[model samples]
Target: MIGQGFRGPGADIGDRPETFAMAQALENCSKNPIDPEDGTAIMTTDHAQPPRAREQFRQHLATVLADLQETAAQDGEAVALIGSLATQLSDKFRQASWSRAKDAMSADNYDELLQSFEKQGNALHQAGRTKQAYAVQALATSLVAGTQRADTVIAQGEGLLDALIDRSVALYRQHLAKRH
Candidate 1:
């Protein structure tokens, strides 16, 4: 199985430099696998990620949020657009996580096995973390636009759930691959 440490970089989204460094180290180790007894394969190092990628991800997230906000502001189109945005956001997260997991696993860093597991677990947990917040904001926006209704709210919630299923299936495939 691919080591978990290699998976850390994709999942690390915090202010701590140390965390990023550790994740980078794990990624490096995965890329350059060495004998466990050899001191050359160190487990930790200070590695900085490219700023451009981070900025891009942040911008993408902002764009999604803004789009959801704008969609909710509409009256007749609220339900349809909200459903579509939620589905799109959910797909984005799933694709991102799958890409990360695949990259980490392909690195072949044995030391990162545990960390990869953790990343998988954490990714699964936070898969839909933004959905609740988005739904709330969407609901608020809908209310402001006089589009609030139990049916609309429930439909939005159901659409989000469907998105979660897509993510879950992708994750499960990764998990199954690791197991076999």
Candidate 2:
């Protein structure tokens, strides 16, 4: 019993208080068979919400909108991109209807789409689609120029929408890190 953590027939039931406590702990664990360190049940399901990048992007757009209202910021490629994103994200957020799930892609999938925005645009652009070609060219230009002129980017056809999002996320994170 001493070697086996005082379990299964030790002659003395009345031992040190510490020994009784240890035995009680072992009995409780045997009865429960759960990991106690993390204070979490083993059979629980994760109910966490999705990543909030799109939501954050929406808020960022609102800030831009406010800035525009107050004449604190000028519209640019970033504005154009943000406007498009606002519309799309609105649908995803179910602002229009409850049945948006069929048409809406998940935020993770949307992020992936942005990452391959160039490739996807080029695929259509190369097929002699006039509008697509224009968009691809514009997005490429915005990406190469390293500027956030959202209007021109949208108007010209397409620009590196993913890069714009990535850049915004990085900048926002940097700002937060500094604030902390």
Candidate 3:
């Protein structure tokens, strides 16, 4: 409970920016809950994630994409159709995010949720939250753009689903095998 009751630097958790984690910590557990044998408290941070977490996520992403590719292959026309859809959706998505129109994705009323998802996903990847970023990308991949297919939308907007996922997996796996 050391960090509790005291608003140390960077302890800001809410609007007041004081005694935030303190309250949660106080409510969650004993002042010094320790095991009779070990006599120590476990410490971890939700915001500060480990690097391997991303590597694992990268692996998971590769698996999901590979599975998706296999499943998509069953549709016969899915690859070609989705590629075409990807192109259209990417164009529209770009128009929404980067174009000068007031109705763009950046606009308050237009697809704000999607904008948030894309921005947050990229930020996650940048912050070593690769798994979460991949999840976000996967979410976007499942969402349709107007009448377009979900796979096509995500593919056209950022990358071909199969290629992006495959490359990310290989890179992460290699990195994982290298060092801590």
Once superposed on the true structure, which residue ranges of model 3 sit more than 4 Å away at CA? 1-49, 77-85, 94-180
Clashing pairs in 1: 3-112, 3-113, 4-112, 4-113, 4-115, 4-116, 5-112, 5-115, 5-116, 30-109
lDDT of 3 by residue, 20-99 (tens): 12123212221223345765432211122234432333343344455445634453233333333333344455532111
Query: Could you tell me the lDDT of residue 106 within candidate 2?
Result: 43
Better of 1 and 3 by lDDT: 3
Taken over the whole model, the C-alpha lDDT of each candidate is 0.33, 0.31, 0.34
> Against the true structure, candidate 2 has what lDDT?
0.31
Model 3 residue 100 CA deviation in Å: 18
C-alpha TM-scores of all predictions: 0.22, 0.22, 0.27
Q: How does candidate 3 score on lDDT?
A: 0.34
1-180, model 1: which lDDT tens digit per residue? 111121121223343222212222223222333446754433222223244433332333333334543443443233343344434433444543322322233222323444443343344334533333233233222211111112343235324433433344454445546889
- Local accuracy of candidate 2 as per-residue lDDT tens digits, 50-149: 2342233223333322333332134333333433433344345554321132125443433343335445444543443333322332222222222122
TM accuracy, model 1: 0.22
TM-score of 2: 0.22
The residue ranges of model 1 lying beyond 4 angstroms of the native Cα positions read 1-49, 75-78, 81-180
